[model samples]
Target: MKIACSIHACSLSCSNLQHGGQRLLSFPLSKQRLDQSNLRTMPKRKLSQSKILGCSRNPQSAVGAPRAKNLKTGQAEEKGIGKFRFWTDARRFKGSEEKCIVQKALYEAGGVRIGGYPKASPIPGPLGFQRPEDWDFLWAPARLALKALPARPGQLVSACPGMMSLTRKRQLSMTLKGSLGEDLAFSIIPRTFSLPDELEAFKKYLEKQRSAKQVKNGSAAEEEAAGRCKELAVGNSAAASDRNDLWILKTAQHLGKGLKLVTADEAVREAAKRRLKSKKAKPYVQAQQYVANPLLIQDRKFGIRVWVLVTGLNPYRVYLHCNGLVLFSTHQYSSETWRTEEGEVALGHVTNYAQNMDGMVWDLKMLEDHLGKDAFDTLWCRIARNTAMVFSSALPQITLAHEALSVQPESTFELLGLDYLVDDQLHPWLLEVNGTPSLAVEHEDLKVEAIISKQKNEMVSDMVKTLNLASRFEPRYTSLRLAATKTKSLAAISIEGSEVEEGRSEHTAVNVMSDAADGQTTSSDPQEDEEADIAGVVQNSSMDVSTDGEVSGAAVASKNSTRQHEIRDAAEHNFTEESALHVVSGGSSKTVQTVISPADRIDHLRRQLREEMAPTTDKVVWFRVRQELQQLGGFQPLMPMFPMKSKSDQNVSGHNMPWKDRDNELVSMLGKTARLNKRAAIAAEKKP
Candidate 1:
């Protein structure tokens, strides 16, 4: 499509070497337009101006609408979205886990949800809708459909692209192993060896353990070694339990489906070999070291399921839900629990919520109350620290994986369920990270179900608020925090004559139509010196193109051009405060500037002051995000836990406390900004 443009040239010149003559010249808009003998006329369809410009007549009907109308002029203009239209595939979410929460939040926020159940959202797949890009967001468990059609800009996705590196069992083990080599602070993950791939490594580890045991028993290593071993051994039972060499064999995929607790004996090793050699078997297994001394609650094994929300990947933005489930085993806890036969049960050891249907589940607050404030506080610190370290270490892997896709970090958000088990020493051990956590609350008691349901609702609501899904689209909205620091304000420019510098002119004529309509050079002959000079002057002018392709800038002339030119602002341009005629004399040190019928600069300043008195776009957004986080309805920030110095020395700055000093440049800046805002608020309150 060709845009109708009119270029008002302040100066024009042409030179022909062959003809030996100088003449006034102009270039056609396009070669194609000039060459075409027949032009196709646009169909005459009588439509409202609002409909033609893609604006809604009624503001209330503009929910989840893309374009917003100008408040003052009533013209439709492209704007940043206030609310997003989401599409969810029920097939992607298992049994209404994610679908329920997503639809509920979308309904509450006045956003539309497209393509309801039996099938997934038809926007992303191959046989999809006509305009898949119309939907602003997509919610699904897997990125299979997204891979078929890459997400376009202005579209958000509920899942991160490369999260499989952290979610998959084998990938996560390998990622953390390479990233956190000697960082013992994050050594909460147990010693794990992937079967079939790391079979030799697993054998070597077992051999080393046996050799160390033999050396401890027979050889006279040292008196100090003996004393340390004696000190480590609290009792004979504890020493025996440590020497048992217990391991859990589990599949890499699925939750609590094929868990088997077994002692690493000759029989077990031979059985593993048989399974690997078998023609029918192709199991992805992980031989993980079992936690022998688990911190039991009411003589039952338990594990904490934490909800971690990650808003970005490159520069990590992580949050933790304050309330989570403490899942308990149905049977009594025992280190000796193991499956004897092929179908024998081991419910006493595994604390999987799915497997233990009749198991007890308590909220974080309940556990905190049970353990008392001080002990729970200490335990919470460990959990938060370990969680931060894991993500910090895994950031590179996740980011690298995401690089293969077209997903934008700003448009992707993920909610991960990280499972952690506490040892007898109150140290939290990392179990696994779930990309698709279950939100189903299944219990016989109505009271427990209600409590869990309320928590999930609050979490979803807080997430929506933090994402700023309810912000209205303002076409003329200016972020003063960014604009003030980045560009000179129009109000600050003097309407009276300002002195021109030696090399720079105060006022120059800029061809707005030529620059904005199309970015092309206009010269009929390249060899002509005068024509080349004219093209150079027009090409070098600075411009700032907004998202909607609107250009805003002051015209700049050539430093060597001597001829003066009069530039007029477009009559339709609403922001034109005044028009100036520039007079540049040949080889002069300064140019004579003339301002004609200038508008009230004081009024512009007053408008800016009034806007600044209220919160700016950036300030309002920052405060809204901070407020949602600080409310702590059901969520808490994991990295910036205390907003002070970290107990561990790994923190990059005092502001982002407890977060490991890795990929923390953006995090530090945010923390500092928050602190400055807090100080400003305190100072404002104390004013007389």
Candidate 2:
């Protein structure tokens, strides 16, 4: 047997040399010629095949010849046909190179490779060297291969470089394909571009196209055009109509004197025109010219003016700035009215002093003066009518002025500020009349700044407005009269106790005299007489009596007369002691006895002497005689009623002379003697 080898001189040598032995296989003679010829003519194919098989052929040698190599002992056998190929033993492809070709093609075209011992040959791990051409070998399992790569920007770019090129749209489309080949191709292209500008342009173009299309659709387009046209027409129409109406109204107003166009509607205008024409047809009267009184207009009644007392120069400027009334002195007075031009008025001859005083004072004075005498009189009367003088220390000048006005006969009077300057002697001078006096003195000590002046001005103004002068003065006179009546009534009711007591004594004397005149008899005994006299004196002293027995009028007159007489008598006697005694006796006694002729006086004296002597001598003499007899008899003396009757005589007269019986017998004897003596006296007088 024999086999040809491409090495230098090698040949198959497996022949048995017997009739039954198999011959060693040899390259066909024709196949060898065809290969030799085709190899020379197709050098590129052969070189490609050589590269595929992971072997190189010498460019100068014939196709079937193998390149020389150093033969080392125990060199490892080549594993596969290509750079990334490996050996695999399988029953299906025993000793068949075609099977290897098929396997390499499938692996290169992204197919799985299957083979060999232990069941399958180990595929290259991810770290194993890979041929650039064998990248598709991993395509079937590239997802897993790619996952195994480090997740870095460069690695990702290497794995799927085309991803950077695929546009956002293309990438999305490719992603939808779900095919690894297209996805890989799509991901591999570079995507560098001006992305932002391109996108903006693209969007604008798209929008433009859409808008163009929308414009072509005439229903919406025509409607929009019509709407715009209608808006413009309406605006123009409204403007023209407004202008026309305004022009018409202005023209109508111009043509019709003092006429106003009140309505926009033509119908209303026509109606108004008709009414105006009708009104114009009627008669017209000229308006009267108004001539205001100069004095009245100049007068400042009820007007409030504010004054700022400034210390600086150009006070008038400040006043002018403040809108104040100003006063200025001038040499001449003007008689012309407001219509005529006249110079300043002389200060000295200013009839209204109020006009001369500037600022708030001027304002007040002008107000009062302008009202004139009659009006001011009315105003003052109204103010004073019910006003009571309110005495308050807070406003001394006002209170004093009020007091003075109250005492005055005129019910209305002007208020004045009397300033006192003590020039050696203290006397108040009439500084000025304050027709509109300030009621507030509370802020007198404040600084004279603009603010304080303004405040004071405002306070005074407010006071003027709030004050009801008419209401304040109405009831003063009535109240004063009532007060006076009360004082007089009190004085009239007051009385003294001594005067009342004297009146009572005089009344008692009268009572006693009256009782005596009534003929009421009393006992003549000496003790009874003394008791009566004491009673009369006590009653006279304690009782008040009038001579005429009346409490008023005639009784008082009689009493006064008696007192006058006593006084006269005392005066005539030069108040001698005896005359004083006589006067005193006249006041006490009811009657006085007078001395007449001697015989008559003698008899009266004899009777009075006998009456006095008998009571004393008889009582003493009888007590002594009774005591002598009582010692002889050792018996008590009998009581006697008759002055000289003895107890024994009383017994002989058959009187029994029981001591009580003796008293009865003596009483009877005294009665008989008194009768006998009266009878003897009567008889004696008859004989004479």
Best by lDDT: 1
For model 1 the TM-score comes to: 0.60
TM-score of each: 0.60, 0.12
Whole-model Cα lDDT of every candidate shown, in order: 0.50, 0.24
User: Please, what are the lDDT tens digits per residue for candidate 1 over residues 508-592?
Assistant: 1222233235442221111222212322111110111111121123221231121111111211122233343232324346665
lDDT of 2: 0.24
Off by over 4 Å in 1: 1-82, 97-99, 119-131, 145-150, 182-186, 219-244, 266-282, 343-345, 472-634, 640-665, 669-688
Clashing pairs in 1: none
What C-alpha lDDT, on a 0 to 100 scale, does residue 34 get in candidate 2?
A: 17
Q: Write the per-residue lDDT of candidate 2 for residues 532-594, one digit (tens) a residue.
A: 121111100001122221145565456546543432332223211122132122535476643
